[model samples]
Target: MSAASEAETRFEREDTRRRWLLSTPALLIILVAAVGPLLVVLLYSFLAPGSYGDVRWQFSSDAWFNVFLERDIFDDTLAPAWAHLSIFWRSMKLAFITTLLTLVFGFPTAYFIATRDERTREIWLFLITIPFWTNLLIRTFALQEVIRQEGLLNTLLLKLGLISQPIPMLFTDFAIGLGMTYVYLPLMVLPLYASMERIDFRIVEAGYDLYASRFGVLRRIIVPLVKPGIIAGSILVFIPSLGAYVTPRVLGGGKSMMLGNLIELQFGQGRNWPLGAALSIALMAIVMIALLFYVRNASRGGPTHG
Candidate 1:
């Protein structure tokens, strides 16, 4: 090689080496802080459950099999774990419902904030974020009070004569969905407003000038523009709502068991660490699937509107 080419190659090698050296700390942190626990859980899932809560050294696939199937003690026949299936169904249903509910409420709220003057927008955005200042558990407890019989909601209904007695609102699936929606509404709103804020109002006016009705302008112009935000916000709301523990526990009174609660039950009272590890891996897999779906859609570059 020529002297100049050799010198350039040497410089490139040193630069690459330096970059690796600089990134070593971050790589180590990720390996230890993130990958380590996941590795431990993955290992535990293949092990046998002990008589107590921990796992035995022996390898077993019972935990994984038990994820979807259970053996009936009476006839020694294997059957689908209907209880687990129902809990999984409920989790998915509630998460989807919560996403829809938040979108329904957040789209308009985001538009309102995004359309306001800069100062007013700041105030409105600040109000939207005020919920984040409080701890999640505390916020959940506060929600519990609202839907509890004889609390604000039922009391208002009673005073207004809308109901003869306080409605049985608390400790139900309705309470779970309501709590999740309230908790995740801000997540939906912030992303939507980010997308809406960048919109040019002139295009909307141009659509109107072309004799487009209010709904037409919204359907063709506004939604197409904010599609990215809708996807992001729905993902943000849905993922956490699926894995939620505290909100369901307080609101559902432990009757409405989500996947999170089920996992906890395995590790704690059920004394099935292997099953818990398997469940944890299953939850992680579901999360990865959701992320893959998001990535697939988020990477598609076709224009939402012509």
Candidate 2:
């Protein structure tokens, strides 16, 4: 309306345009690198496989159908792919267990760190993150050495006369679970601590002053306040655990297979690129569903933890 108001509006529009221009490079990179490849994969999922490493451009529903059952391409006879479905279910189960284990261990660790003085908290946080300094493969190998029958744990137990023979620890589901927890515990703790750190101590004190029990206060006030972090950390741990290859391979002795291993098999030995692409797309769909749920939950939770 006024000349000065019009000038302010123009300035704001110019600032917005400048911000978009500045972000264009990142947008272009995402389009070309990530989205472009994803589109190619999606296209491949709908097509048939070539004899070698290439894909046939002919449209087919075989890849999608193959996800849950095996079918003869010529005769059209279908059989249940119980093995494939079971692998997916097993991956989900393992991921859920890993998330629960991490939450159980990490909550107290995070709370302790959150309650500490600033310097002490920094030291504890640094200690938690020390594992990241080493290569993951090297760390996994170290774990393998420790858990192997003739390795450190068994040897120490033997010297102490705790057992006549080394206990079977490697190549079991338990070993894979342990590996997942060890790797992903930091991911859980960091988010929980971040959420816990922002909680108002005065509210906690008020709860105590009102004669609320510790558990009561924690459940009613603290837990609600930090629900976002719990969800965020769960997503971080669970999704990665579902797709875990190294832990299942090395620790589970390659006998216990998960979705990641299945996907790798399709691409590597099986040489079925279309099926691999379909599997990848399925994994992506699962992740997107989790994210959508997260977004809906965050919106309902409001600004405090959202």
Candidate 3:
């Protein structure tokens, strides 16, 4: 080969090597931080419990079997296992509601932002993101205070003679769902914005030129184009909402317990590590199955944004 060609080839090889070397640390960190913990958890899920609530090295499927078979764990007046199942279903419903509410509130706002002037879009986007600057727990607590009987909302309504008594807003499923939607709305918006921003204005204009109604264009073109964003945002909101402990714990009171709370109980007051590990694994399995179903549907739906 000519000297110039040989030099270019050597440079490209060295560049590839340098890039790989640069990426190695991040890859290692991800493996150590994420994969390592998952591996430990998976191992723990298969082991038996020992004295003092330790995991014994003996391999056992008792915990897994109980979870999979939905066998009752506690033989009380209110079966603890049934209670846990009820909590799981309730959490799932709340998560689904939160996801739907976020989508309803976020999609139109994102679409408007995406279609607006750059400066106006930035301002609206900034407004949407402002809430994220504060701690999520603080935001949830703020909502809790606002919804309390003597809090700002009820006080204002009472002064206006809107009601005779302060509404029992706090420690209800409605409050918990509202808290979840408030927290997760931004997550839904950003993805929808990203997806909508990529849509070609030309295609939309073409639809208009072909005498398609605005509603038709939106329903046919925009919605299909934004399906991936919808899926992503739904998954983002739903999964976290499912595993959420604080919002339900605080807003739903003791009555709004979820799988996350159940897991926490196992590790805390319950002192049943094996059972906790089993529950954790079960939760993970459910999430994975749901994610797979989402992926399958999204794939069948045609082209995705990402």
Candidate closest to the true structure, highest TM-score: 2
Superposed model 3: Cα runs more than 4 Å off? 1-15, 70-81, 297-306
TM-score of each: 0.90, 0.94, 0.87
TM-score of model 1 (CA atoms)? 0.90
Return the lDDT, model 2, position 127.
Answer: 100
Query: Tens digit of lDDT per residue, candidate 1, span 117-211?
Result: 99999999999999999999999999888889879999998899999988898998899889888999999999999999988888999999999
Ten-residue stretch with the least lDDT total in model 1: 297-306
What is the lDDT for 246 in model 1? 93
Question: Clash number for every model?
Answer: 0, 0, 0
TM-score of 2: 0.94
Per-candidate local distance difference test:
0.91, 0.90, 0.85
Task: Estimate the lDDT of model 2.
Answer: 0.90
Ranking by TM-score: 2, 1, 3
Candidate 3: give the clashing pairs: none
Superior by TM-score: candidate 1 or candidate 2:
2
Task: Report the number of the highest-lDDT candidate.
Answer: 1
